[model samples]
Target: MLDSPLSARLEASERILVAGAGGGFDVYAGLPLALALRDQGKEVHLANLSFSRLESLDIDAWLDEDVAVIGPDTASRDWYFPERALARWLDAQGLPATVYAFPKVGVRPLRAAYARLIGRLGVDTIVLVDGGTDILMRGDEAGLGTPVEDMASLAAVHGLDLREKIVACLGFGVDAYHGVNHVQVLENLAALERDGAYLGAFSLSRATKPGALYLDAVAHARSEMPDYPSIVNGSIAAAVRGEFGDVRFTARTRGSELFINPLMALYFAVDLDGLARRSLYLERIEDTVLARQVAAVIAAYRDEIRPRPPKAFPH
Candidate 1:
């Protein structure tokens, strides 16, 4: 039952890689979909552009120069290793706990890492899951939020040859704190729709099995890393559980007011190639070998363009 365009597109794929585009807890955004795919008897794998200190990992953990296989017992000194946290959670659930992680490198090395993973995993489809909508920012927005990791993942996957490439983003308005304008996100989606890139959106309800599992996974992660739980996933999980306005799931968002609405539970997906084509500065970062180089390129590009003024949603 291909209920949505995203599912329909993925229907033919046997091996799929759902990767975290913006690193950190971004891969958690793909959990529901990955679980649902597994339920449908498809082989789904998890990976992330890791924000952890990969340099501390043992040499045997390295699957490639920039890529490593994170497991439940992967030794790490970093307290905020989301990949290892997720691996532990998966292991507890008696699921495959091996998560492929890439160091925070630039597009060149990142792309090479992705290529190695795709080839080794025999992945026919790649879904880049972003925890927030910041990945949709096409370079000229008034605020780009955190575009470095997102754009790097986009550019890296854009260079890959695969049967299908998709981008799925959860946590719609959560990027407000980072200065992302939801109006601009909508405007960008409209543009993608015009380009035939928008795959439409869907909601994750707590009533469903995948949603229930997602909540459990998030709760486990929170318990494991109590000091540094993901604010983004916490907000989304709150929304999924029918919480509203300033829902306080974690102390991380203490000083800030959160608009925890049902919309945060919605997943907005698009064609990866279409998104890559839409990013005005994606090409400039293609040859980058270091994360800082990608940041510098984006900074220089932002300096040249007169950004579109941020607009409020006039409802």
Candidate 2:
């Protein structure tokens, strides 16, 4: 029996795809949920919008024109391949090591690539995961905080036909470094709730098996790429361990002060299509073929609207 609406929505789903909506270490944000679901005997697959240079990969790695299959042993010219690093870590744990990677493209081609993958995998449910809450930002926010990749993924997946489409975000306040306002994030979530789209929140604890494995995976990834450790996941792992107030897990956040509170460990979910429809400019980037084009459209949209001034949380 599923207690939360998020779990209830996914209760009937047997084959689930947990894909990173934002590129880079965003897929790591979905690891705990994927691991927990897999432990329940559900078939879960992992994928990411890769920041790596997919063109440098061999032809055999290509699952489609835009999708690449990255395994533990997949060769790559770039040293910073998050997908490959994650695959290697999963392999070490005796789990599935193949992670599907989609090149950073605009919505049209990205949606087509997703369609092909969905058909091939026989996926009935898709949970698009974002490392931070910035994916919840609407166009009228004071700052969008690097929304190109996240929006593209949302727009693409929202168009797909599936039994369930969900959006989940971890590392709540981490996007402040990227100029996001947490007050707005909360306000947007309130709006989503009013629309019957918001799913209740839940926390991950180090006491759980999935949480322990997630900590191990993040530590392993940090050791693999010390120079480029994921600040978001590191903060999240810290929160799960009951840490608080400016916890520094890596040198990447050495200069910036962090707030590693319990909120950072919580996962907030919403209906994907509801979130997409609330985005004022999603339609503007629908025809974009390149990532830069989506950025340009968002920039233009921002210029045309007077952004709501950011507010601080009232105690």
Per-model lDDT: 0.94, 0.94
Q: Model 1 segments beyond 4 Å from truth?
A: none
List model 1 lDDT by residue over 84-122, tens digit each: 989999999899999999999999999999999988889
- For candidate 2, write residues 185-294 as lDDT tens digits: 99999999999999989998899999999999999999888899999999999999999999878877878898989999999999999999999999999999999999
Candidate 2 has an lDDT of 0.94
- Give TM-scores for every candidate, taking all chains together and pairing residue i with residue i: 0.98, 0.98
Q: What is the TM-score (0 to 1) of candidate 1?
A: 0.98
RMSD of each candidate relative to the true structure: 1.1, 1.1
